[model samples]
Target: MPRFISKSLKKVGSSPGTLIHVGEIKTEQSSLSMLHFDAETHIEQPLTDIGEATSLLTPDATTWINVVGIQDIALIEDIGRHYHIHPLTLEDILNTTQRPKVESFDDYLFIVIKMLEHDKEKDSIVSEQLSLVLGKTVLISFQEDEGDVFNPVRERIRKGKGRIRSAGCDYLAYALIDAIVDNYFVILENVGQRLEAVEEAIDSDLDADILEKIHTIRRELIYLRKQVWPIREIITYLQKDGAPLIGEATGPFLRDVYDHTIQVIDTIESLRDMLSGMQDLYLSIISNRMNEVMKVLTIIATIFIPLSFIAGIYGMNFNHMPELTWRWGYPAVWLLIIGIVAMMIVFFRRKKWI
Candidate 1:
């Protein structure tokens, strides 16, 4: 079963605003990490409780609180209560099957997007839902598990690279989203490589599993398209909705991310078209191979028809079969058989059918 469909089935009868964890339990326990930074100073620490998040927020410094696991409903509730997040937003955060979207609230903006990574060992794409809440001086990021593609963003924050250190929480939110969108390129690059391999296999060597490979890539593209297509609208909303949490300085950067999203979507569509073409090409190759085999079998059958007829006539124990009783009949029949076969071979060669 596809992960998207299977995870959504668990929420069939759920009421509105119900806090229920809907996806895979990626971590044993949810963990919190805070990065509070300004233009010159930075403080990074792990909190033992959600209550600590309030104390870490400062007027001068932008705080980024990262929750590594979302399976703990109580923890999510605590964070929601502390942050004044809406129950519907909290429900969306808990329900990992939520689509990529953005909701604007009075104090904060709720953004949900899928963070995708290529799992090399499994040779497949792994998706985790990421929910971001952007407030005045703080931004809280919720993830499904520990590992993420935000290490580069973290390193930038740690080293105080670019304008991120001097910027507001909106800029930080943009940075994190830009990181996710950038990682899409990396994942798409991996998918592109897989598509190339499949194409090469289809052209050079038609393995039995080539169709399965094409299908696997098609499914991955479908999954990726599902996750990525809505992000254009999400980014567009963030740019145009005039959410107070999103600053004017972040507009250009958001536009940049929007362009990148468009690029990613285009790449996905191109890969999908390539997969469809590859599928048709695979079918054509298989059909041509079958036709070749059938043609050879038909030719062989055609060649043997006369020989079988002669042998059938000779095998009949008719009282006076002239050819069967003649002394030279056996060798003559053998010569005739060979001559007919040679003539058929020459004819086939002249017709370019062999």
Candidate 2:
């Protein structure tokens, strides 16, 4: 399926802020996981109800609610009502087509970003919508599917390898966003490797499959561009506009992430140029090969032109023709045709057109 087809198709006539799930709908209920932790204590639980999850959000704890599936309309609505999130924000969360953006609300800061990863099995880029609501002491995340690119951040939080253990909810938000951005680097690396393989294949010859691969990579780059470009704006807003939900100490890290995004954008642009050049290179290769074939055929026809005329002249039966009566006439005509073909071959070889 096309990656972005997760955008709800059933909302053609539905009103705005209607609690209708737009993406894939599953029969199985959505899974909710909770991580409540502070500097001195940590608690992880699997909650079957949003109410259970809400009760655990004490004032001293920093909680991360990861809703594995966003297809449950009632579930999302209940949670939104409990947390005092805006209806429009819930609408965006359900829509799943929301671009990478940051919007300030009365209670929390809402962030919607595309989580991109290279699908090695499919050899394509796959994207999932990740919605984050950053409040004073809690960060709620929503995703379309159960799998995500947040495992590294979860691992870091569990290991306490960094200042994440000591920071507030803002830092946790930063950590999550940072993890997503870091995966961009990995995605780009995979794309770079694919581009390299396509380029190397072009050196030997051109084929329909190679051309298709070029177009596929071009499409991937375009998709990556669409996802990457808007994220720069999101990061810029978070860094320059200084959303209150973000910490003062986290500003530097946000700036660093902004720089990383800038670098990623720069790399994406570079790869785009390279992919464009590869397209031109593919065309040039095909054109040169075509010209080579035409050159060879033209040479063969040029060599045959005089030989055809000579044969045609002697082929007509006429009593007035003198060569027809000679004993060596057939052998002479054969030698003359062979000699002309040899001379043409030599001339073509010397001209470097063979």
Candidate 3:
């Protein structure tokens, strides 16, 4: 589960206070990769030391320093020192569970987004926190792990395709956000398919396994919706809050990302509604099975009512009963009881109540 840290934790590098590890502690070390690029040329390098990354952050060309892991607090602090990032911002970066948000400062703009990817074999969704820092001619990103959904953007930058290379750092930020949002669609598709499979199985007999699968899908969707809803507000704030770091040219792109977020929210809401309906349907099916069981038991008791009455009458020892004295009377009474039971069975069959 992802913990939403309080804004008070935003205090920059303040005493390493109470490091609340929200999710998992990855085994990988925090590594830095620098991609310094311009319209005509590009350069990418892996940094062994944080100081080596600072010399590459020049105003002459746009730089994208991608941080792969974030467990090393010292490295993060050093990078913060180099860029003059606020302590609170550093805290947010170290805490990968932070919500999607955008903040503008005198020197740079900070944006946090959650990246979603679905693992088919595991049948689970993986979430990664991607934090982007935009300067005049550079963009820095920190990821919880290596290999993100930004490979497409990297390809675009490498191949010099489209306007990505021609644009500034803000445009790169838009591209990164857009890529993350697009991957949400992929995840939603998988979830929708799983829901559909569960629904089809539900149509026959309400299998316990099927219902459990449905429940699992519902839980995942709930988690996804929780993660995405606030992102809508984050994008809206970026578009309307008039952040200085977001360029006028990049505003429309960010607005486009806002639209994508809205689409994601709409899809999530639909999934939730579907899951609710599935729950109700499962309940009805289980109830119907229970009613059928009760009906069968009641019909068996009904069929035995007259038979029991016949047995009770013969069971009485009455001196005035002349039939009890007759030799064939006992056999005749047994035949009569059998005949009555046979008649009841036929009647139940005719009524379709058995």
Candidate 4:
């Protein structure tokens, strides 16, 4: 779980220093960076001073300021001041647990999305809130941590590989969102592979560990859905909203991003079904195992039932018991017991319940 810190929104002429934290706080500190690029040149730097970076915002070139951490209230205030961001917007930024949303203002657009990264070492998905403020000439991004999911986007911009450099802030925003969505594919693929492996293990035998693995994967998928579902709503809002901030040229591209979101949703639904099936399968396999155990116990019980009866009859010290005086009677009774056991074994074999 992550704790969203409270932000004081004094400058927006609303409540002064109101205490509100909207999101989960899984980590204590966040990282920050910036990427400024245009059609010709691109620059990336780790920003320490908000004022200096704010001064660097230019109308002629596109700027992307990436904030990895939002724990410091002062830093958030400084950034808000630099961009003339609304108090409510700043509050939302600090409140990292916001649902995915897109808000259009007179001068810019604010967007919140979840960035999901799967840690192979931990075998878990690390979800962090990614906030984007798309202005006319700059696109500022706030993240919960410093992760390399955007490396491909950075490289694409660096090499001028696509329409990224030529596009405006809206397109840049789309590119970043699209990149994150693409990473979801990677995550799904990994999960799918692990699921296949689990299926194989389950088919081989119902091991205790397999259930744990199935449950772990299922839990991760549930978390992934929590991170991804809201993003779809956010993108859909951006697409349908009649906002000047989102360019007309970016509509088709945003649609592409929406499709990816849908794909993610579909994959999640499928995984959920698979998880349910796996649980049922585990139950059935366990039941089958218990049945086998019970079958063996029942066979042993059946063989002993008659033997116990015969022994009880012989043990009864009665004057009318003539077999006690006959020496061959004991051997005959032993043979009878052996024959009963053999017949029961053959009957069990015929029923294929042995």
**Predicted candidate 2 versus true structure: per-residue lDDT over 10-119, tens digit per residue:** 77778777776665553366889998888877778888888887778777779999998888878898899889998888989987777789998777989999888777
Which candidate has the highest TM-score of all? 1
After superposing candidate 3 on the true structure, give the runs of residues whose Cα lies further than 4 Å from its correct spot: 1-22, 318-320, 327-335, 338-354
Question: What is the per-residue lDDT of model 3 for residues 116-181, given as tens digits with 9 covering 90 to 100?
Answer: 888777898877888888888878898888778888988888888988887888788889888888
TM-score of each model, in listed order: 0.95, 0.93, 0.89, 0.89
As a TM-score, model 3 comes out at 0.89
Residue ranges of candidate 1 with Cα displaced over 4 Å: 6-14
| Winner on TM-score (1 vs 3) | 1
Candidate 1 yields a Cα-based lDDT of: 0.90
- If ranked by TM-score, best first, what sequence of candidates would result? 1, 2, 4, 3
**Cα RMSD for candidate 2?**
2.1
lDDT of 2 at 55: 77
Q: Give the alpha carbon lDDT tens digit for every residue of 127-212 in model 1.
A: 99999999999999999998998999889999999999988899998888899999999999999999999989988999999889
Better of 1 and 4 by TM-score: 1
Worst 10 residues of 2 by lDDT: 1-10
